[model samples]
Target: MEFDISWILMGFPAAFVLGWLASRFDLRQLRRENRSAPKAYFKGLNFLLNEQQDKAIDAFIEAVQNDPDTAELHFALGNLFRRRGEYSRAVRVHEHLLSRADISKPERERAQHALALDFMKAGLLDRAEDALARLEHTPYENEARLSRLAIYERAHDWPQAVQIARLMHSHNQGDYSVRIAHYLCEQALGQQAQGQLDAAKDLLQQAQSEAPHAPRPRIELAHLQHKSGDPVQALGSLMALASVSPSSVPLVAPLMLELVKTDKRKPQVRALLVANYHSSPSLDVMQSLVQLDEFARVENADGPVGRDWYVEHLRHEPSLVAAGRWLAQETLSHEEHHPAVQRALDNAAKPLTRYRCAACGFEARQHFWQCPGCQSWDSYPPRRVEEQ
Candidate 1:
């Protein structure tokens, strides 16, 4: 065959032209698809911006169908579903993302976190807890632990709450010493309820060591001791608390006076109460002083020490509680109507004696270490509502 060099040269340019045309065609097709995807996305965004949730969801669905590998779109859809209270659908979306083998580690963890949130929003606490537990070694560990802590607290699982709180503390999350002490105190209360007095005592001691300046553990321990017929030990605990947590002294003053009477430590306790009263001038401490002085007068035939104390308190501060107390014991000319007048004074003083939570403002006749209203530990100040 004769060599055809002219034909070969002509065929090379023709083939090159064909290849260029095919490449251009393919690029145009790709550009069209890319443009369509963004158009659908923007349609969804417009619908969302217009508060047309149903239309927006439809647009997003179309976009996701067009690009099945869009992880960010899937996440957005899942969150939208969760926000709209469609938790089951949200869980399905996130779980589908998690089950995909092609997802990266970070994406998988994110999917898991999203699924946990879905379960949490749906009120499936057990499933949420399990999902959150799997995120412990991931970047979401701290957030997961905090959520888990909230879950355990809601369930009143003190041991689990304490464990998570300690982990967070070790990780430098925050100062959880006070919370840890509260947990221990809760555990002690549980043990006491179950008739495990010795175990309760040990837990309370551990709580005291955990937060030396916290008032709850010592106060609780004093109550336990008083219940166990060890008034002397109870008084000692109160005395220790007065030194360590002086701000809480008012909360325990009445109990301190009762312990003093029961334990025959009147003189020492009376001195301490008088000193605290002078320093803080709390109504509780004043009432305790009055009781102690009345008892002392009965025991030693001394004249009224507390009547003068109340009158002197009125001199320093114009306290309604102090005035009421002073008036209750005074002899008026209209002594026949004194009972009715005393009833009115007692009624007026009732609200001032309630303890209130600082975080939630929950008032109660008894003091609380944890707020029943907000489930916050140590939210209640160790002061009466009026004092606060």
Candidate 2:
């Protein structure tokens, strides 16, 4: 320990210079990192806009690695993965965002929604349902509920569908009464198929109570009544159908004719059909009238004046179906070849009689409340293809 005050004083400035140099190095490193993150992000965006998804994904992954706390970049990457059908990667990216302690509340909810979508698009409905349930009360609540409704419908979970529909109805999201009615009717059909006749009847009645103006409830209820040895009630339901849903009168015309034949309510049934025909004339109703008139003539040697209503319908609409029916009933000079000619005409008119979906242009021989091809509700118009 000789006197060393000068050496100690020299060491202080050297230490100060070293500390300043170290601080400068740290700032330069931070700047380079900040610049690298943006470069990779912009590169990813450029690739995404060019439809070069694979390169975009690589660039995004690099950016995420460079700056892992970037929630926005993670979200974009997750969506990109989901769009590319890489559900596992998408789920991981979204879940990673969720695990971040620094993420904001809104961002956490957004990541949850993205994760739910990943499950949904991957067809993992059960997982998607649980994920969607967690989004209630958030900004994504209504959209989550809508997706949930669709999922329950596809799963044939009528009770769940009804619950969501009622919730949506109460919130004024959209009028769900008709949708609720259809769900009840679907449940009724399921019960009926399983030999639960009483349960089926109860469900159909509930469906009717839910939507009195809907046609399916009344039409299906009549089928149950007819099966239960109550032709009068069955006929009454159909009569109610004619008044409430005149456009659907054609669908049940043949059923009404059968009831009239069995129950001998010819006068009443004829009047109902006539009134409906005048309101909305259709080939189905017109054919039923001809059947009734032809049967009446054979039974009582008299029938309505418009037995040739087909000939009259042609006067206004030029309906090929009407023409075919009229020709089939007439006698030709070449009577032996008339069967061949009639067969050709009837076969040609069959497609015109089919129902067509207005939304998707899918045609079917039978009417559907929901189009099987497009999965759209009320897509098929009540009128047949020829009329439409």
Candidate 3:
């Protein structure tokens, strides 16, 4: 049969009209969807601003569902979940983002970082370490390395801490010399505990070299030397420490007193103690001097006698501790009540003898290089609480 050209011409306009109507319908639907996504997002933002987290999360979920390809929405949802302590949900959201191959490079790295944060917050340390390790050489490298360093420190993995610290130092991230020295000192302590004396000494020496002005390495080295039955080296280390870091002399005062059996160094030690005491007037250094003087009185008549150091300290500072020490040796007019007064004075001075953390104000009977409360290194000053 022959086709009618009129029929073909009639069908063209009809199809064109139908196609126009369909296109209009699709455009309207697309506009509705686009409007709904933003509406949901803005609603979630409003809820978040009002601190209604539950409603905000619901709105965010609705927005994400409507626009699943919105990477920012996914990030916001994941961060919210993490903030709310729903680490599993946060991890799932970030992992889903990572699974999608359509995301850009920066987005992918951001997702990885968020995923690592999720693992860290969930206390999955090994998984967190793995995730953070993948971020090396990325823009987030420094932050990841610092987090790993903290993890190593919290785990007492001093060797790993040292490694990361050296890397950060080499990269010019910050001056980590003191921190590296601390890590080496920690490693030396572990070695010393295991009876590896020589290895411990070597590590301590390396630590001292790393931070010449830091007092811990020298102090620890002196301890190791003393333990190895080498009083001469121990005295030398302490004496060098007094020269390098004179403010730390109080920490080594008792150790200096222990070296009195090496009588040849006694004059030098007494002079060292006197110089430190005169310069800083530390109660600890004064106590060491008094002890040395007590020993000296036994040998020669011309040696200094009694608790005159306490009187001199009182002359410098109106210290209750000095007064108590002076009263202990003084012959009071009312001798019967002296014991009661002394007991009261000792009780009152007990708190002053404690070491306080400069960062967290945590008081301890003994000094800590790291605060037990805040875990900050070198938080405690060398001086006692009263002195501080």
Candidate 4:
């Protein structure tokens, strides 16, 4: 209480020295912690680059423990877990980050996306869908919508797929007209299966209107028409398709051949098949032309026979399939061995006739609008492997 200026001055200097020492100690400790966290993170990254996932995960765990509040560290660890197929751990880490209220908006969205990815990896589609739904209006909206589209497609929820596809198309994300058409076609098929012929026809017509140049809608519509006992209309649809998408003529040739019941339109059908064959020379179209020619030969004895077309095809291209087809119809000089030769040729030509996926190289006897192996649309070309 008494005035002690000398004592007060000594106490002030001593307090200043203590404060400086304490601050230096704290700064050193902080620097050491920062260095340790970075070291662990880098170690994890190095392990990952070396393809040592277990070591990388261990290192990441250490880094996360060293910096519990680091959102980026949490993200890295969660991603690592997801990549390692430890989806539960990945979910826990991302959920922990999401529970932290101190994270920024962007960080929260990022965590949400990560959590959705974890759910997807875990095959918790319902949960993944719910998580993805929350990402709308965020930066991850487009990606989330695409993921949801895949989920809808997988579930065969064509209506939902169509809705999402239309939304993406309207948003200028991408031209989903073809995809929408496919969804409509799928729905049409389902309707057709349920004997809702009129409804199926309506959906197919809408699909055609949506993507006029697409081949599947026309082909599907023709099939439905044929199924509905309107062979004439089906033939007309297929003929129009040949004009619109010439590359699809091969697909429609068999259907056209089946629908040709009247002798009056035989000439017109023959001309279309002949024209298509001249342009593309598809084996399927060639087969259709041969059948028509054989029918014509029965009408006029002087007309060229069906087997003559194979020779003409051979003149255009050296095709094993053509050779085999020609040989099958030919009267071989050694008739006794013909059966064995035919069997060998048929065996060799079988695989070449299979359609192959352009995306995944999955070969099938029948053509597919979508590759079953890769879940890719329009992956398989309309033509067979030999033509390719």
Candidate 5:
């Protein structure tokens, strides 16, 4: 053990010098890489800020080429491609990032999300859905599920939409009960179309259970009852709807008026309409009350005619629709030109009958449970444009 003292003393200094040289080499290499990536990245960022998207993409592509291991550069390049509508190139970039063995967990999830977006933009919905499904348990789960829900709705797959909606609800994403009810209603409509009335009824009942206050299920059930030759039951359902959802009286009023054929339910239905109109004044409710009054006149009840009902409605809301409607029935002094004046006023008031979406400003003559422009469920208010 005493013979190697000289060699051991000399070897320590040699090893230290060798280590220092190696460290310097590594530092120099690292610095060169740092310079290359940052220069290209900053150039790309500058171009992006200037709104020169094509030039920004070129700079990012160059940065990614200079540092192939830089995941952030790849993400930037991939997102740029996607935003520019170059789905093929975006898919290639994101897929390349996902295929790498050394990508971090967060980066991998990001790549998966980017890949899904690329497929969605490319209109490859099946691929996009599969890519999004893999994001469960990750931070992107909520966003992934929301996109999946949209896909399910766009494809008219109510079962799948219901599945995702239940998952979202369980996770406390938002109040999805109404959304679940809408899915059930859509399923019921499908069953009804297939001549499966019993199945449809079961679905509607489930929907009502899911969202008890939702108006569509109640309204739809009344329609089904009426079609089944059970006008009494139909009238009962609408009455229940009016009682619970007074705001929707306008929507149910016409149906109530139609169901009130005999004098037995005439007073009850009339009283309900008047009560609802007093609470929530609307053009639809007013018109229905007028129809009920007209019925009373035909049945030799002690009520005034339809035109007088409009005059009563005008007292509460000062509605142009009510005014125009009343003018239509009155006999003007200039009788010869009354027809032209009435026609002009009626044409002007026609737009007041439309239903407009609260979410997207889409207007339609018919009220919708979903907004066609924005694809939002229950976006249209129960009231017509004039009442709104």
Candidate 6:
């Protein structure tokens, strides 16, 4: 056999030409497909830039239809739907992405997160809770847990909120001790409402251990003690609070006066209150002093402290509240018109007695642990509006 060297050389060139032509054809087809996707995408982008949301959605729909397998395009479309407040459509797109088996783990997690956000934005809390639970072991775990915590708070599910907070705390997410204490206090309040005094006490004790420096648990515990006819114990807890949180002395002063009156410990309580008042000069402490002195005057008809304390307070601060108190007991020269003048002074001073939230400046007649206006905890100082 000759082995045909010329034929072999001719066959090589023919095969090379065929291969080149095949590659060109494939490249042309790919370029056409690529060009079509970008043209639709740019049209959508242009519509979006022009603030034509309806037209942008139409262009995006066209682009998505042309490139149905593109995860990025689907994500963009889903987010657009969500931003437009079209929750149902956003849910559909994300659900479709989740149904695809070819989606990577990270992409699936992202899609799940997006679906949860859609439910939350649409006020479907039950559905959002389920979706968020599924994200627990994913990379979005922390964010999902935080959202779940917020949901639990809104639902007043304190135990579940505490569990999530503890988990986040163990993972070093942020300091949740104070929040946990608040949950315990809330649970204690619920128990108290149900006439479960012992259980409420136990929860409050736990709350105190959880956040030793927090004022709410101790304050609430004192209230419970006072309710149970144990004003002495209540006084003890309040004294502990004053020792630990000296700035909160004003908050406990009135309670101290009541406890002292009930227990016949006025002299010691008056001394403690007078020292604290001299140091801080709070309106609450001064008011408590007035009460203590008035009680002493009844016990002894000519007590020196009873009628002179308000004058001393006036000397220090020139306070309108102090002046009003002093004027209440004075014998004015125009006795016929004194009642009308006193009524006017009291009306003008009424607003000064309200409590104001430090965070939002929302004023109320009673104190609050959380600001109703801004939903912030520990925002209201334990003082009257005039004191602030």
What is candidate 4's lDDT per residue for 6-61, written digit by digit as tens?
98888998999999999999999999999999999999999999999999999999
The model with the greater lDDT, 4 or 5, is 4
Per-model lDDT = 0.86, 0.90, 0.92, 0.91, 0.87, 0.87
lDDT-superior candidate, 3 or 4: 3
Q: How would you encode candidate 5's per-residue C-alpha lDDT over 277-345 as one tens digit per residue?
A: 677777887787777677576444454356676877777777777888898778889899988988888
Top model by lDDT, which number?
A: 3
How well does model 2 score by local distance difference test? 0.90
State the lDDT of candidate 1 residue by residue for 197-255, as single tens digits. 99999999999888889888999999999999888899999998878988888888988
Give candidate 3 regions above 4 Å deviation: 298-306
Off by over 4 Å in 2: 1-16, 298-307, 334-340
lDDT of 2 by residue, 1-388 (tens): 5897998999999999999999999999999999999999999999999999999999999999999998999999999999999999999999988888999999999999999999999999999999999999999999999999989988999999999999999999999998999999899889888989899999999999998999999999999889878999999999989889989888889899888887777888887887887777788888898888877653333323445688768877879888988887787798999999889989989999999999999999998988999888878877889998
Compose the digit string of candidate 6's lDDT tens values, residues 255-299: 888887877666767777777777777888888888888877534
Q: Candidate 5: worst 10 consecutive residues by lDDT? A: 297-306
Q: What's model 5's lDDT at 327?
A: 86
TM-score of each: 0.85, 0.93, 0.94, 0.95, 0.91, 0.83
Superposed by TM-score, candidate 3 places the C-alpha of residue 51 at a distance from the truth, in angstroms, of: 2.3
**Any idea what lDDT model 5 has?**
0.87
Off by over 4 Å in 5: 1-30, 298-305
lDDT-superior candidate, 3 or 5: 3
